[model samples]
Target: MGTTTLIAVAATGLMAGVFFAFSVAVMPGLADLTPEHARGAMRRINARIQNPVFLLVFLGTAVVCGIEVFQGRIAGGLLYVLGCFVLTMAVNVPMNNRLERTDDAYWPEYLRKWTLWNHVRAACCLASTVTLLLGL
Candidate 1:
């Protein structure tokens, strides 16, 4: 049961993280190339997609992983989930919140940090995928 739950949570995290990574990285570059109105529309779309409910779902997956790990199955998978949690809390969330407050003047710099954190997230997601494959 624990292993099953861990795998399920990890899979969800993998998908969300991968999607977020692409959005923060490739999507922004594409947005930059787009016209101003298109960029504004894209930003609005992204904001809607990244609402608190979405964040809760993402965070809830990590919490579920912890519960599964406490049951003594999928230790490595739990580790990866924990890593993702740490990165999210320690880096991504704070940076994102800060970026939200800053004006367009600092957007480029914030975008760089956003991309870097996304890369970190991608690594953690890959780690989770590996853990699932290894069934550790």
Candidate 2:
């Protein structure tokens, strides 16, 4: 595999691990907490997850994978990038912004829906990793 391809697949795999962690551990743990406490924790987490290193991995993988797609392999790069990344920016971020304004009473529904979509993103990231591995 080329350096870019190796980098893309590795970054995507890392992202899948992050998603899986959230789905299996983070979200489930949050479910047991009081809504106000959960919201506070999630708000901090949301901010922390946006650090420079994460962005580089997330977006850098997408950019490299996209190049591979155009080079002829149908790498399924855009599936994860557009599906997971775009959905996060569109649906998840909006919901998170709403949560900041919303009452603690609504946290349950928000958590349920957010986690549901997160699972979808996780699946997409995993799929991206697997397909890229095969392509390599």
Candidate 3:
């Protein structure tokens, strides 16, 4: 229960909540809209989510997890970094960038794939939180 690990737990939990909300509420709400409307809304959401507060939680949590990994909180920290952070960097972000560049025709596939991967991220964040708490 060091301060760093506590921070890791809080951050990861927050991330999990965000992803979970998207999975359960946001995406579903978007899906209800027409493709053009959904695409536009998602694009705006993607842009808006890059703000400072979100970045501080997202990137800052990854940085903290990296530190935790080296400090021997390997299981939880590594899971957060690799599963959530790296996965977002590798998969979700690319899809989002593609969504921004492409037209509404891409919305169906994008919604499906993005939501699927987001579920993964949410699970990872939750698991990371639990493991980190257990490690404490």
What does candidate 1's lDDT look like per residue over 1-136, in tens digits?
Answer: 3555655555656655665667666657645753444335445655776777777756666766666566554664465566667777787668656655655555566556656666666666666655555555
Give the per-residue Cα lDDT of candidate 3 at 88. Answer: 99
TM-score of 3: 0.98
Give the alpha-carbon lDDT of every model.
0.61, 0.83, 0.96
Q: How big is the positional error of residue 39 in model 2, measured in Å on the Cα after superposition?
A: 0.9
Best by TM-score: 3
Residues 1-136 of candidate 2 have per-residue lDDT tens digits of: 7776677788878888998899999999999999999988898898898899998887787787788687544645776677677878888899898887888988999999999999988888888888877783
**In model 3, where do residues sit more than 4 Å from their true spots?**
none
Runs off by more than 4 Å, candidate 2: none
Q: What is the TM-score of each candidate against the true structure?
A: 0.67, 0.92, 0.98
Return the clash pairs for model 3, or none: none
lDDT of 3 by residue, 8-126 (tens): 99999999999999999999999999999999999999999999999999999999999889888899998899999999999999999999999999999999999999999999999
Candidate 2 clashing pairs, residues 3+ apart or interchain: none
